[model samples]
Every structure is written in C-alpha cells, then in structure tokens.
Target: MIIDCIDKYELYQGLGDGVSKALEFLVSHDLEALSIGKHEIDGQCVYALVSEYETKPADSSFFERHELYVDVQYVVRGEESIGYAPLQDQVVVKPYHEEHDYALHSGNASFVNLCGGMFAIFFPGDLHMPGISDVPGSVRKIVVKVKA
Candidate 1:
C-alpha cells in the first residue's frame, strides 16, 4: 500500500496519468461540500463518499485482497482510527467467500489515526479497516475512489 503524504502526490504523476488527475482533483476540491456519489472529471471516475457516524466499520475481509482502485481516505473533520494488517501476516479466522470476495482472518491487527487531510492507500494484499471511533468523538471523512 502506498501512504503518500499530500505534498508528495506530484512525484507520482508519471505512475498513472489518470491517478495524477484524480489526486489533483482531490487536493483541489473542498471535501466537506461533496455528496456520496460518482463524479466524472477529466475522463476519470471519481467516486466520492461523505461518511459520518452512520457508516459501518470496514469489513477486514473485503480489504484482504483485490486490486483496489486508489483508496483516497481523507478525513474532512474529526479523527478516526483505521485498522490494518499485511496479507502475508493474515491467519484465516474464516475462509474466503467467493461470492463476497472476502474472508475473516485471525490476529491482532494494527491501526492508524486519520485526521483532516490525512489519508491512506490500500493496494491488493494490504488489508485495511477504517471508520473507527476516537476517544474524543466520531469523525466525518470522505473516501475518493480512483482506478489504480
């Protein structure tokens, strides 16, 4: 998984022309005003989702595998703790479901706190768990999905 600091996004422009454009759009836009839906910009698919307390905790099973479209998890407001574990480290607590494309694993996972402007990227094999609560309160975050 690539954990890019917002400032270093420019360096990755050559990686994928579309990804560069997607990152540019995310960096330039005001996340708070957006709705949860798909937005087409510069011929790229930008799926925007504004999440509040109503959103459920991310299913670890889902993130264990799958080539992700870049997962730009930005916290527009408040703090959130996200869980993570490497694929190689995973011990299957539950077998994968072909229909759902996920499986539950056994182990103590790691977590990271995402605040305003802070984000994380999860590629295939990088299992991530998001939407966790902080001690102070809940968080409002926006996840922009871009094809990787």
Candidate 2:
C-alpha cells in the first residue's frame, strides 16, 4: 500500500506500466470535473470509477482484496478514513468473484485519513476497507483500476 499526494505520483511510476498510467491519469486530468461514473483509459486494462457516497462506520465494512487489479483511490472531495491491513492470516468472509475481482475479509486494520487531493494505492495483497469515518459525511472519490 502507498499513500501520498497526487503531485508526487511520479515517485511511484516504476511500480508498473499500468500503475504509472493510472497515476498519470490522476495527475493529468481534472478529477473534480469528471462525472460520477466509469471513465475509460486503457480499455479493460485501466479505468477510473467516479463515485460519491456517505461515509460509514468502520465496523460496518469489511476489508476487500482484488486479485486482478491494483486500486489507486483518490479523494476528490471531502475527507474519510480508509482501513488497511496486510493480506496475511486473514479469513475470508466472502469468496472472490472474478467478474468483480474482489473478496471480502474480516480482520484488524490501521486507518488513514485522506482529504481532498490525496490518493492511496492498494496492491493485490493489500486488504483495504474504504468509506470509513466516525461520522457520516459525503465523499467524492475516483478509484482507478489498474489490471494486475
């Protein structure tokens, strides 16, 4: 997992071609102007999903892992705490669904607060629980899916 400002995206460019492409998209485009829906970049290989929703309590959500994609989640508006845990010794609450590329897990995790303009990268082995907060609040986030 990696968390940093969008401007520092170049530092992580070497992670992979897809990751670099995702970072480039985050930095190069006007995320706030994007509509709330999927935006294509590299077809199925890479794309961004713009979504807005109310934050939920941490306990109400479970950690999720993706086998086929690395998620580059950027907060465009408002702030929220995201939970992260290493994908080890965790039990799956729900099996993986290949079409969605995700599986749910229940485990302890550390939380990071991300405000506008911040982003976090979740690799395949990173279990992440997003949309977490102590109090409910609106958040607009762009999640770039990079094929792993």
Candidate 3:
C-alpha cells in the first residue's frame, strides 16, 4: 500500500510498468472532465473507472481486496476517510469472486483522510475500505486498475 499526493507520482514509477503507466495516466489527463464511467488508458492492462457518489458512514464500508489488480484510487473532487488494514487475521465476510477479482473482509482498520489530489495504491494483500466519511458528502474519484 502507498499513500501520496499526485504531484509525487513519479516517486512510485519503480513499482512496475503497469503502475507507472497508471500513475502517468492520472497525472497526464484532465480527470475532472472525464465521464463517470470506464476510461481505457492501456486497454485491459490499465484502465480507470470514474465515479461520483455520496460518501458512506465508516461502519457501512466494507474492506475489499483485489488479487489480479493493483488499485490506484485517486480523489478528483471532495474528501473522505479511507480505511486500511493488512489482509491477515480478517474474517471473510464475502468469499472471493474470481470474475470480479475481489473479496470482502471484516476487520479493524486505521483511517486516513484523502482529499482532492491525493491517491492511495492498494495491492493484493492490502484490504481497503473507501468512500467513508463522518458525514456523507459527494465525491468524484477515479480508481485505476493496473494488472498485477
């Protein structure tokens, strides 16, 4: 897992070609103008999903993990709290779904405030609960999926 502002994206380039490409796409494009849907950057290897919605209460957020992809979640607008926890010792709330590449886990996590221009990278062993806030508020976020 990695948390940093988009201005420092270059520092994470050594992660891998896919991650580098994903971060580059985030910084090179006008993400705010993007439609609320899937945007292909490098076909299936690197693609981003733009979404806008009201934040959910922390207790209602579920920790999710993806196996085949590393998520580069960038906040294009607004701010919210994101929960993070290691994969170990968590009980599976929902079994893994291969087609979706995710599974839900129930565990305690520490929260981080992610405002606009900030991003979080979640790898396979990182369980993350996003779209969380003390008070529900609108947010526009982009989640770039990089093939792992």
For model 3 the TM-score comes to: 0.98
Runs in model 3 with CA error above 4 Å?
none
Give the per-residue lDDT digits (tens) of candidate 1, residues 86-146: 8776676667675534466655567777776676766545677677653446577766666
Model 2: residues with Cα > 4 Å off, grouped in runs: none
Query: TM-scores, in order shown?
Result: 0.70, 0.97, 0.98
Alpha-carbon lDDT, every model: 0.63, 0.94, 0.94
Candidate 3 C-alpha lDDT tens digits along 28-100 = 9988899999999899999999999999997876899899999999999999999999989899999999899
Better of 1 and 3 by lDDT: 3
- Superposition TM-score, candidate 2 onto the true structure: 0.97
Which regions of candidate 1 fall more than 4 Å away from where they truly are?
42-45, 54-65, 89-106, 134-136
> Of the candidates shown, which would achieve the greatest TM-score relative to the real structure?
3
lDDT of candidate 2 over 102-131, digit per residue (tens): 999999999999999899999997999999
Alpha-carbon RMSD to native, per candidate:
3.9, 0.9, 0.7
Candidate 1 residue-wise lDDT at 22: 64
